[model samples]
Target: MIDLLAPELKIVFCGTAKGTISARTGSFYANPSNRFYRTLHETGLTPERIDPAEFRRLLDYGIGLTDLNQVESGMDRVLNEKHFDLQGFREKMLHFRPRLIAFTSLTAARIFFADRTIRCGLQDRAIGDIPVVALPSTSGANAHWTRDRDHWYQLRALICRAENPSWGEEQKATE
Candidate 1:
């Protein structure tokens, strides 16, 4: 699948690799059970729930998408170290410079971090100055983690704050 990337995007979502459905459909997150587009809409990132085939439209909402293992297409269990391209991902981040990078699964983040123990929010380490985060996989196979939407909400809040300095001030005042 083609990467939907551009310069100065607010956030870029990175996944482990394309699943069979996504690759077959030539779209990002094409599996009907994937929650990626739905969660984006729920968190106010997108005005509407977008279909996976319309993945390019994400750039209009200041979001981009990519995969760590661009050459492979399958579940994580079937993938190995050779399938991933850490240097390529790093170079892409440095070049495009999205404000934040969100790994769509812990497995993807772990692979990127060189098997280091990492968490589900923003990390201390960054690709140059761009912040990095790990979100629960939106894949149906990973429903246990996907059910928690807090991290996704926090990401929206962070993006809002970054774009507008006074964001959430009214909510705080009312509270």
Candidate 2:
């Protein structure tokens, strides 16, 4: 799968692998039940709701998209360890150096970190100098496991701070 990436992106969302629907459509998070695009707009990550087919347009908003298992398209359970290309993922992040690498699901974050105990939020870890964040799975199947979208909001706020250092003060003044 071709990655939607560019240098100096604010966030690069990394998922475990594309689903069958996404692979077929040649788009990231093409599954309608997946709330990937909706969440972006809802969390104020993007100015408007973007269609999955137009995913490449996300670069305009300083967002990029990629998956761990590029050669396979399926859920985490259906995929094997060898399918995940951690080295390739590292190379991309090192080369492009996005400000943040946010995993679309906790499962993806755990796999990349090689630590099963990792939780959902901005972690104390780094993929080199870049920070890593974990968000809830927007998959319809995992709907029961999600508590709320606060983690995503926190991520967007962090990105906002990076974009505008005085964002917090501006927000306080507005309130």
Flag clash pairs in model 1.
none
* TM-scores of the candidates in the order shown: 0.90, 0.90
Local distance difference test, per candidate? 0.87, 0.89
Shift in Å, residue 55, candidate 2 = 0.5
lDDT tens digits by residue: candidate 1, 14-39: 99999999999999999998889999
Show where candidate 2 strays beyond 4 Å: 144-146, 161-175
Query: Which number leads on lDDT?
Result: 2
Tens-digit lDDT string for candidate 2 (1-175) = 7999999899999999999999999999999999889989988888899999999999999999999998989888999989899999999999998888999998999999899998888889888878788988888878643685678878877776655767889999999
lDDT of 1: 0.87
What TM-score should be assigned to candidate 2? 0.90
